[model samples]
Target: MAAVTETLPGAPTTGTGEGERRGRDRFHRGALRWVLLVVSAIVALLMIAPFVIMLLNTFKSPDDYSAHGPLSWPHEFYTHGLKVFWDRVDFPVKLWNSIWTSGLVAIFGVALSLLSAFAIGIGRVRGRLWIVGVFLLANMLPQEVLIYPLFRMMQDIGLNNSGWSIVLIFTVIQAAFGTYLLSSVLGTFPRALLEAASLDGANRWQILWRVVFPVVRPTLSVLLIFFFIWTWNEFFIPLVMLTTNDTQTVPIALASLQGDRMLDVPTLNAGTLVSLIPTLIFFLFFQRTLTRGITAGAVK
Candidate 1:
């Protein structure tokens, strides 16, 4: 046999060029990731800066706020500003009124809408289209149009200038849109489930309580938070409905505090800060529900 020419038949060589190309690609990708991270961090900080400014300024004196930059640390932390704002704004009463009015509005609004949506959105309902169209039309009406009629009705019912008046208006305004929203959510639910419940001798009320209510809890939580925030911040309705300090909500009270002449900047800022507390607390409680609801609603 001819002596086999010892040729290394295959020394598998990693091509230097290909290896260099992959290394370059990985380097670029890593650099891009770092760039993105830095950009996101910067954006987050920018968004948080305004809140930091507000919180710090709440504790600052008028002179300190004016003398130093908004980002500056206060030389003295004082509750004087907060105390002044509380005394001037009658925060306790206003806050209590806001909480009461908002809670009633949310409760009535959600309950009414949930009932309406179920009645109309379920397959058993006849004339669903007409009812939905009517709701849509009502939703489209300008809130200003209802003002006169509502005002007259309130006067007739002895609800004028009372917390109940505000609560009633909020409920009315919220019901139409709330119905639309919940109907959309209900549309996403499987119809087979309803049929199954009906076949199992579950009454409409039982289906609503056991099957529908659980699935809609997240949506309800989101709506409650939104209604609370909107009612808390509502100025126009409260302005028209209520004329007395005793019944006024926080926004009205805050606006009244910042009258044309007596400009107490520190006190105004402090009250503004205080006004945000309830909303912040509300968000803290419902944020997870809100996020999940939005995600689930969108997908369904």
Candidate 2:
């Protein structure tokens, strides 16, 4: 009629088709996001369920627990179990011993690992791979296999049943793995920064502390946290070494309550909860540092 235009065959058309495709894509993406959220929530619930159950049972009386089960809530709020466990274990002393030993081990172990990794990685020592392999092998060795010899050695050194002995032993053990890990990270370190520092008349030690250390500090902080947690949770070694009540850590103190025949479930749970509080607090305080360090490492 009024000069109508005819489109050629296979000509592109823009309208509802593209809009519908985009809408479908957005809908699929939203559905997928909801699915992932549901999965993550389910996983989180599973992870937290045991802790919730433990908390519920911790305040339960032995009679109440026997009547109802571990999963059931307490009929009445009870403080007796917590007080009994706290006094029986000398909670303050055990907490102090753990803090002291774990703190020292973390500091000493991080220092040792930093020095060893620097020598092997930045120094580029001959046969560095073999040195790293030895560390790996040492780390792989079972604590049980070394426990007897370690015990004998500690006895000979007159450090048996001392918190210092546990500190020293765990420091060395933790450093071995730390060295192996830090070495790899340091090996791939940028040469440009090191060269720049060298050109600025920086010696090896100065360069290490001033330039390299700052960049790698994040990784070291991560190592410090790991060392602290590892030494904190050490049961077998501490159990064997710290035989005395005053010298023992939290785990040993809690474990001492377990008898050959009867077990006080509520008391044990209360102690367990108390023991976890310190570590949980430690982790919470350092949570930001841990996250920042990890993020820094990832960015680099």
Candidate 3:
């Protein structure tokens, strides 16, 4: 029996097999991470390259630009483009309008979306599913079809050609999609959390503020960033609704810089750069929230 014990079981001849499998798994994970990192870096550079070239072009004189490609570096940096931008454009007024309109749109849109999303997500009322479906349908519908009716409605309501009209239009248009996106996220939140909060005698408001808000914080950040960026870059809404210089958003004002026969590349690039700063600043400010929120939503 003692002599046969060594071969009695169908055990592996070597213990290295399990260790080898683990090593392979670790190698695969490491290789995948490095590949992703490299790909992300390359994509980021590609996205930013055009902007960098624009910046370099801004510093170059017209003579240099004409003689060389836009991608070529300037021999000497000059402030001529900056001067031209500041002198020609009414930067202060347009900048103010852009800031005010975009801020109002983002704030109000996010607020309305939160209420609507929470209703569909947590309430699960009799027609909750139907309501969500309606929102999704609206989201899928073309904006062009909605514009005419919206314009007539705004006219009847005495909101046409006003900043508030533009803000309201953008907020409402964005709310449908925002509500759907946020609700999808909120649905995955643990129901046990709400139940525990209720058992502790917390009302709906308390649950929202304490329990739900904490968990949904990341989703809110994403909504804020999305709405802000969309509203900031919005062009057509302002063009149609805000017909006057006083209420014109940045994009509309910038579009007016185009001439029938000639194009001013420096001024155009300068304005483009100016328009991007606020968005970059906004994203930087909330980057931590954005990253964490996206990760949280994705992980679950």
TM-score, candidate number 1: 0.84
lDDT of 3 by residue, 63-174 (tens): 7777886888887786677677665667777888888887888888888888888878987767878888998998888767777888898899999988888788889878
For each candidate, the alpha-carbon lDDT, in order, equals 0.85, 0.93, 0.82
In candidate 3 the C-alpha lDDT for residue 166 amounts to 78
- Candidate 1 lDDT over 80-178, as tens digits, reads 989987887788999999999999999898898899888877644787777778888998997688889898999999999999999988887788888
Clashing pairs in 1: none
- Give the Cα error of residue 129 in candidate 3, in Å: 2.0
Model 2 residue runs over 4 Å out of place are 1-11
User: Ranking by TM-score, best first?
Assistant: 2, 1, 3
Q: For each candidate, what TM-score against the reference?
A: 0.84, 0.96, 0.83
TM-score result, candidate 2: 0.96
